[model samples]
Target: MEVTPRLTWNEEKSLQKLLGNVSLRLLYKSSVHGNSFGTMLNKCSCQGSTILMVYLPNNVFGIFVLESYPEMSEHLKKPTTSFLLSFQKNKIMEMTAAFFNSTVDLIDNKLRFNFSQVQYVLLRSNTQNIFIPRLLGEKLGLTYDFKSQYTEYEVFRVEGMKDEPGYINRIAGATPHRDSLLAELRAYRPYADLVSEIRILLLGPVGSGKSSFFNSVKSIFRGHLTRQAIVGSDISTITEKYRIYSIKDEKDGKSLPFMLCDSMGLNEKDGVGLCVDDIPHILKGCMPDRYQFNQKPITPKHPTFITSPSLNHRIHCVAYVFDINSIDNLSFQMLAKVKQVQKEVLKCGVSQVALLTKVNNCNGVLQDNFLQMSESMIYKSQVRDVNMMLGIPKSNILVVENYASEREMDPLQDILILSALKQMTRAADDFLEDLPLETDAIAGMFQLCMRCQLPGSRHLAQTGIADSLFETLLPFMFCLLSLRASN
Candidate 1:
């Protein structure tokens, strides 16, 4: 006997939104085939692109697989482009091949899932929801163990609309390319001898994924999904303190040769978000990590300010994060604030790039394959708008999707993120290469002092020499330092 799909109209609509206008065809139902792992596998085998839904007392959850299930397997199969979905929470978490290989198993006439190294059986109970241990429940975002009987479980084969356009072919050997890109980034070194690590600052409006970008970059190296930074959606900025984040190699635990500095998001309203006046201090590297942002910007009088920041402390590059969905409709005040911040950045001679984030939210086609972002008309127009608005070259603008609700690492996502990071490092190198040498800076300082006609400047001008270069350099250096510090 065949049973109807249990998904409601709203649930089906939400799935289409994520998977891009796909229809679901029921393949198996627990009540019809019996609550046995073998029977369920037999019915679902060879059904490509399936959605497996499990019903609890008050919620529904499932996994969306992009490949067909084999008839039998002692080991788990790789399922790239797959994700876990919770209908009640309206959340979707991307699943990785490595996670799939280690956590799922079919044995003893039951489907088993491993969480925190503990195995729990599923699809074995006909009268009730499968008992989920506390740890497993927590992983599923459930506050308590679910004890209610399972209403039913169903497997559906996802079919795309005939009129829907096909995805751009996956880049050849994209997985291997991801590995190579990771290797390249891991071996990166700063271009300047005086600077051991380049610092890239993230600046953007509130809820633009500024903090989330740092978390995503860190997660790529960590080899798992991590939420070291607090992230949420709100009218106000979620990040209140300036944070300097460093990524560590997963194997040797050595810190990478770059830092990502996060600041409060820019708000259009006065006395909100990141203060525009703080930009100069941040670019010059005077602001300390974990310094709280206030209604007013930091000044030289701030106790936490660094008086003599070194070359390594200064920002090597600035990444302005913008939501792709909202880039077209940016408020006038917000654009003005961004331009004002850019001016401060320009004064310090720092390099800048624009990072367009939340690409998936803007275009449904990108949810399955972010690599196709370049082919998306919507994506291209948004990038163009960002380029025009920021005055950054089109090549310097990068698109990326941050890990928001994933428990595992996806190779495709890694490729996009690492590529963006690679561009940022290259930009930092350019900035370092362009820096004036110490002797040149000193010479320029002397010329400016002579032209200003300070005390003893007339004698120095007449003699074309100074009694002591060191003595003359001292006062000028002090003034320069003071000027730098004040900014």
Candidate 2:
């Protein structure tokens, strides 16, 4: 297979001769042909087993192995848009390279890919071996190797996320103390008259675990696996309407002192996903719960809006959610959009934190075993990346794995999620102190940091983060969050 396609769908006879026994179906054609994925899905009727090939504009090509194509029903049969034939036991299907915003990262027998990173994800699907190239080729085995010699897939190979590997922590397998961390989160209380709960505004591109973050936190307090906030795929925002989700204390059955305010997903394009202008309204708590934002540009003339929002309605903290594995996949447009949104957040003097989700993408700890989160230096490096790219203090970025496809609670996962919650809540507290963002807040923040016994704390000196007292306060805040965890 050459970098550029040597054949097209019109040359089916030649293609079939080359593919041999592997059944081939076209899921996507090029722009000139005007054939789209939606059209392809509607017309796809082949049953049982087949491999779905993705033909991109360039020579970019990829395929997914699907086992069944029974009649489409309400149930989500597959999570991947592309499908392929069943090849193994636990892993019923094989997902090779994916197109769209994010590509599959296949490294050392580890598979990290989010269909959301791609432009779209199909019906829910299951797979055991998601590792690209390696697992994919392992499925095709000798058959693919023999036939691939003549197909465009001969050159198929999985690529890494960055151009040159960035700074990575070498430490492995050691993590913060879990039981203690959970205890701290439970013991944490908001100290204020007007603010009973820390209202954190969750923001991130689609499929970044914004809603999952809420569910993960609530599950800890509920003492069971809970899916209180609706979860969606990478293609759309999981939680559409503006809603508030609060954790319920198990003993009292009353709401916790913290709440997560979820909004529409952030899109790469302007006027898509959540409206940029609406952010100010959301930050102010003017956007009412369940208020659906339309595509048309919003104006003040519209009714059903909060006219006189008080500090009670305003967001105390901002938590930016993102998939660590797909950080490289962030589109240039999306990056700019986040920075612009952040500028607005900074102006509000609200404490902000970056939540890196789908942490399984970074290291084997959360990938195959969520318990290994502490020992994974890769997770630490990912946290560092979020700090540099988004201008969040190094300590402000927390890595977490959301509950997905699992029905039971994992202790370590709960600890990571709770640690993040603790940090954000404290950041909110720092903001509520009413210190100016410019000068005195920095000294106040320094004093706050001195109070928290943060481990390996030096985020500010390391990152040289300045200009925002909120950012300066993150290291110390994280110190408190991790204090008991390390103990």
- Where is the poorest 10-residue window by lDDT in model 2? 166-175
What's the distance in Å from true for residue 156, model 2? 43
What does candidate 2's lDDT look like per residue over 415-439, in tens digits?
Answer: 6787688889888888777744443
The list of candidate 2 runs beyond 4 A from truth reads 1-179, 297-300, 361-376, 435-487
Quick one: best lDDT, which candidate? 1
Q: Per-residue alpha-carbon lDDT of model 1 for 412-461, expressed as tens digits?
A: 66777888899999999888888877633543554565555455544433
| TM-score of candidate 2 versus the correct structure, residues matched by position | 0.51
Clashes of 2: 15
lDDT of each: 0.72, 0.57
Assess the local accuracy of residue 71 in candidate 2 as a C-alpha lDDT between 0 and 100: 32
